[model samples]
Target: MRQNPARRNALLDAAIEVLADEGSRGLTLRAVDQRAGVPTGTTSNYFSNRADLLEQLMRRVRERLTPDPAALAETLRATPSRDLVKTLMHQLVDRTRRERSSHLALLELRLEATRRPELDPTLTRFFTSDLDANVAFHLEAGLPGDRGSVLLLYLGMLGLIVDDLTVPEVLRPHGVDALVDSLVDRVFPPADHHGEEVVGQG
Candidate 1:
C-alpha cells in the first residue's frame, strides 16, 4: 500500500512526543496510534514489531538531528572570528532546545548505547559532524586535537540546560559565560585567549 508522506511524518512526530513525555519504555503501538490519530493496525502494517518501530523511529530522529554538512560549512565560514565559536556553540544549543523532543530521543538512544556497544558506534557517528565542526573552531583557537574537548562542552551544555529547566536561575548572573570559558579550558587545553588563523581548507 502507498503510504501518505504526511501521515508518515505525523506518526514520527507523535513518536517523538511520546518518547519525550514517557521515555522509550512508554512508547507503545497503541499510544502511537492514539497520538497519530491513526488505527493501531495501520502502525503495525508499517512497523511490524517493537524493534522495527524503534529502529524506524530513530531513523526519523537521525534525519532531524544529523547536522546538514552545507549548513555547518556555511556557518563556519561566515561567522566573524571575535566570539564566533561561542556564538556557534549557543546556536547549536538553541537548536537542541527548539526541537527538544528530538533531543530527548537522542538521549534515550544514548542511554541504550551504553549496554549495546555496537549501537554506540553508529549513534556517535551520526553526531560526529557537529563534534568535528566544533573541533575545527577549537583548532582555529590554537587547540589542536580538541575534538574530545568540544564534544565534552557540547554534552555539558545539554546537562546545564537540563538543570536550568528543572531549577530556576541556577547559574547566577554571569555564570554562563564563566562556565563556557571553563569548558574551553578543560577541553581545549592550549586555547590562547587571542589567536589568529588562516581560513582553513578543512
Candidate 2:
C-alpha cells in the first residue's frame, strides 16, 4: 500500500465526495480516481479493496467532523448550563452544515453498512466510541444533563442533521437554530438558582 499521507487523505476526501454524490453503489475505485483528478489506479494503490476504502472513509469523516479544539476550549471556559449545551449543539449544527458532503457521505456509509455485514462491526465501533466520548465529555464538562439527557440530545441532533441534509424543508417551518434551542431546553435539566456549577471552580 502507498505510504503518502497527503495522497491517501486526498483519495479518502475524494471518496467522501463520491459517496455523497453517488451513494455507496457508485463509489468505485475508478470513480474516486476521477473525482480526485488523479491517475487511474491511484486509489487502488492506496486502498486494497472497497471495504478498505470504506473503513478509511469512515475515519476521515470523523476527522472532518471533529470539533475545533480551540473553540471547544473557549466554550469549556464558560459555566456549563442549558445555555452552554445550546451553544455546543448550535456549533454542531453549524459544523454539519459546513461539512455537508461529509455528513451526507456518513449517511451513505451507514446505509451501506446495513447491506454489508462485514462493514457493520467497524462502523458500529466508530459510532459507539463517538457516543461514549460524548457521554464522557458531557459528564466531565459539568454540562446540565445526565447520560439520558446526552442520549436524547444525540438522537435529536441526529434526526435534525438527517433532516437538514436530506429534507431541509421539513425543518424550514421551525428553522434549525430554533429547533436546536428547543432540543437543549427540553432535553437538559433547568439550571438551579445559582446556575449550573463550573467544572472545577468552587
* Clash number by candidate, in order: 0, 0
Candidate 2 on 1-202: residue-level lDDT in tens? Answer: 4389999999999999999999999999999999999999999999999988998898899999999899899988988788888989889988999999999998888898899888889989999999999999999999877898799899999999999989999999998999998777777645457887333222
lDDT of 1 by residue, 1-202 (tens): 7787777777878888888888777878788888888876777766777666766777788678656778867776654433555656666656666777887776777776786676766777666755675567567755333466557766887677665444527875657656665554444454345753322222
In model 1, the worst 10-residue window by lDDT is 193-202
**Top-scoring candidate (lDDT):** 2
Stretches of model 2 off by over 4 angstroms after superposition: 191-202
> For each candidate, what TM-score against the reference?
0.67, 0.92
RMSD of 2: 4.6
lDDT of 1: 0.67
Clashing pairs in 1: none
**Which runs of model 1 end up more than 4 angstroms from their true locations?**
66-74, 79-82, 112-145, 161-169, 172-178, 189-202
What do the candidate models score in CA lDDT, each in turn?
Answer: 0.67, 0.90
